[model samples]
Target: MSELSKQLQQLQREIKKLQRAGTVPAAASAGDESKVRFTAKGFVSLRSKLGLSAREMALLLDVSLQTIYNWEAQKSAPRAEQVKAIAQLRGIGKKQAKARIAEIEAAQA
Candidate 1:
């Protein structure tokens, strides 16, 4: 038991060091979903960064066009599940996002 505890402690110390080095997002290592926050600025920035239009973002996020507009306009916030979906989108690049959009359109066909 002592050996196992020591190994766990060592792993945790490594994680903390990685976090401090900015290699890991703090909330991710902390396992706290509530640490995810929604902001219109962030939403729009992420949308434009992915080179996606509002409609494309809606498709990628499995939301409605109006919902995309609402989020960008700060008229409303995403639900918890939607927030998780949005968080997942943060890691991908434009090409991957476009591919995902294509998948969505194909499925809709």
Candidate 2:
């Protein structure tokens, strides 16, 4: 068998072993807090859900406006700290979002 095919078979065997051992895959093992994988589409959807403009999201996430655009455009992803912040923001309602924005503005003033 080819090296690639042999490697694939080995990986399949490892997956089966993991399944038999009742251990979840590494990708799926990230608990609730880190489970929300950052994707460009998800970033855009969250911004829309919170009714936030790109600038607003930048302020909310404490990133630059250009970073927000980069995230939405899929040209780059948020850093680990930003991803954690985004995960926290994902759970807030619109009212909470507005309140947070107000708090940020107040802090800046």
Candidate 3:
């Protein structure tokens, strides 16, 4: 009834239509290991899924905290090199993420 409810219903209808058409949603179609398209929402989701703080993610990505914030806020996007790093990160588990952070820190030290 409300505007938000109407929007949600419309989205549901669209999703069903896409499903019937055999089209995978971009967010759900990361099956290809060779390439990935970076998106602000995907970046945020990956970071959250790994349980990393913004600072930890920044260190892992070899970028500044401000840069992470900017990406998550959709203020700017990662460069091609950074997107490659992000794709690698997205495919790893939480334990691997921690190990990577440690590896980066050890290398820096």
Candidate 4:
């Protein structure tokens, strides 16, 4: 097999092991519903699942547009704060944590 094919095969095996151990979400048996695959490399399967553009992701992430471009191009890695924000947007953080939480609460009341 070609190097890329071998790499993909390896990744598939690793993903299967993770699924068996309940560490990763397995692909849907029906192949209709999208699955979120969280690998150890911090490359969540958000791009394929959400179909969001880089600019949209940057806006959701509250980071600079250039930052997103840099990340996509591998010119830079996400800083700690950016990583946290991404995790939050990905529904991995405390839901109530928001930049304008106080304002939102006041408006609701």
Candidate 5:
């Protein structure tokens, strides 16, 4: 790869690490928040990737079901702290996400 490509990959890794660490910057604007890789379309895509319903995703993320809908509708963005949960979602697959949902539900019960 070109040096620029290598640098971009490195930067992406650092950003992912920070995100998983819940160190995303405070929300600025809807557009700016998209920089955190949590855009409405991406959110929808990720939820679909996990094969999760809005309610299940809300449970996993510890947010209200409506919040999940709002996110996918671009009505709002996840707060910085909430982005940590989304980051976790990015690291997991359909099975893992379902397992996580089960864990969260068990804990709630």
Candidate 6:
């Protein structure tokens, strides 16, 4: 392969290594509070799962509406405690977050 191609391959391999080591910033293991990756859609899912509007969720989370909006827009994420509260509010264990994701995906099918 060309030198550039080789470098790209090396980078890809490094990324894979990081991902396997659970080092990717967005890839969090179940119940790993410190590694939780909160996406905008995740927030929306929790809100839907709990039948909560944005305003209601903001109230319950004790955060400004803009903060919630920012999260949903991928501008920012909640802190660990907030993530735990969201998990609890959705009637989910931290490990079960993936299951909820599956449910969300299936519902859209």
Q: Which candidate is the best by TM-score?
A: 1
Local accuracy of candidate 5 as per-residue lDDT tens digits, 17-107: 7756545423321235445656788888888988999999999888899999898888889898788668656766787778888898898
Model 2: residues with Cα > 4 Å off, grouped in runs: 1-34
After superposing candidate 4 on the true structure, give the runs of residues whose Cα lies further than 4 Å from its correct spot.
1-44, 92-109
Q: Write the per-residue lDDT of candidate 4 for residues 1-109, one digit (tens) a residue.
A: 5999999889888877875664543333123332333232353355334555565566566677787777766677776555544544453223223333444446659
- Provide the lDDT at 24 for model 2: 40
Instruction: Rank all candidate structures by their lDDT, best first, as comma-separated numbers.
Output: 1, 3, 2, 5, 6, 4
Taking all chains together, each candidate's TM-score versus the true structure is 0.74, 0.68, 0.65, 0.41, 0.66, 0.49
Model 6, range 1-109, lDDT digits (tens) per residue? 5999999889878877775654553223243566555678977987777666676677666688898889999888888877766655544433444444556557659
Worst 10 residues of 4 by lDDT: 29-38
lDDT of 3 by residue, 54-92 (tens): 999999988999999999999999887788778767656
How accurate locally, in lDDT, is each candidate? Answer: 0.86, 0.81, 0.81, 0.53, 0.77, 0.66
- Cα displacement (angstroms), candidate 1, residue 66, comes to 0.6
For model 4, name the residue pairs that clash: none
lDDT for model 4, please: 0.53
Model 1, which residues run further than 4 Å from truth? 2-30
* 10 residues in a row with least lDDT, candidate 5: 22-31
- Global lDDT of model 6: 0.66
**Which of candidates 1 and 5 is the stronger one according to lDDT?**
1
- lDDT (10s digit) by residue, model 1, range 1-109: 9999999999999999987765665566778887898889999999989999999999888889999998888889999989888887876779888999999999999
Q: lDDT at 62 for candidate 6?
A: 68
Native-to-model Cα distance after best TM-score fit, residue 26 in candidate 3, in Å: 16
Clash pairs for candidate 2 = none
Residue 30's lDDT within candidate 5 is 22
**Model 5 ranges off by over 4 Å:** 1-35
